[model samples]
Target: MENKYEDYKNEIKEGKRTLNQTRKELGLPPINGGNTEFINREIAFCRKIQERR
Candidate 1:
């Protein structure tokens, strides 16, 4: 059962579902902001995720 759920979880994570969902939960704007400031903010967010480990 756990394995099956993990498979489903991994499938969604592969599509950036978790990241996008979290962003939505925080009420943040869409990831594709289409500007230099937004790109920098996205990079910062990626770095924050990397640092979590």
Candidate 2:
């Protein structure tokens, strides 16, 4: 049987999902001003994914 964690990981690797989405899935709070680094990284990742499409 496939593990849910591995499935989620694949979704992220394929650019089908974002960290913010995963955060919400896990019931975690969304990123905010206090997490500038996370915001910058996720934004850059999203841009890269968009550029490929």
Candidate 3:
């Protein structure tokens, strides 16, 4: 199965726009950072979760 994010780069791009709009609405910090950390952290978290059960 094709990863949606890989197949649909536009979705993430559009989401960035929507997120910015929401951030501005609430005056939150800009979501500008590498997703690598999220990927690594989630992978580790999932491994831990799977190990538990």
**Superposed model 1: Cα runs more than 4 Å off:** 1-34
Writing each residue's lDDT as its tens digit, candidate 3 over 14-43 gives 675465555555554445566567657768
Flag regions of model 3 displaced more than 4 Å: 1-33
Model 1 TM-score is 0.36
The digit string of per-residue lDDT tens for model 1 on 15-48 reads: 8466556556657665665556986877899999
lDDT of 2 at 11: 94
lDDT at residue 9 of model 2 (Cα atoms): 88
**All candidates' lDDT scores?**
0.69, 0.85, 0.62
Q: After superposition, how far is residue 9 of candidate 2 from its true place, in Å?
A: 1.0
Pairs clashing within candidate 2:
none
Candidate 1 lDDT (Cα, 0 to 1): 0.69
Put down candidate 2 lDDT per residue, 1-53, tens digits, no spaces: 88987888889899999867987998866876698887788789999999999
Which is superior by lDDT, 2 or 3? 2
Question: By lDDT, is 1 or 2 better?
Answer: 2
Give me the displacement of residue 47 in model 1, in angstroms: 0.2
TM-score of 3: 0.36
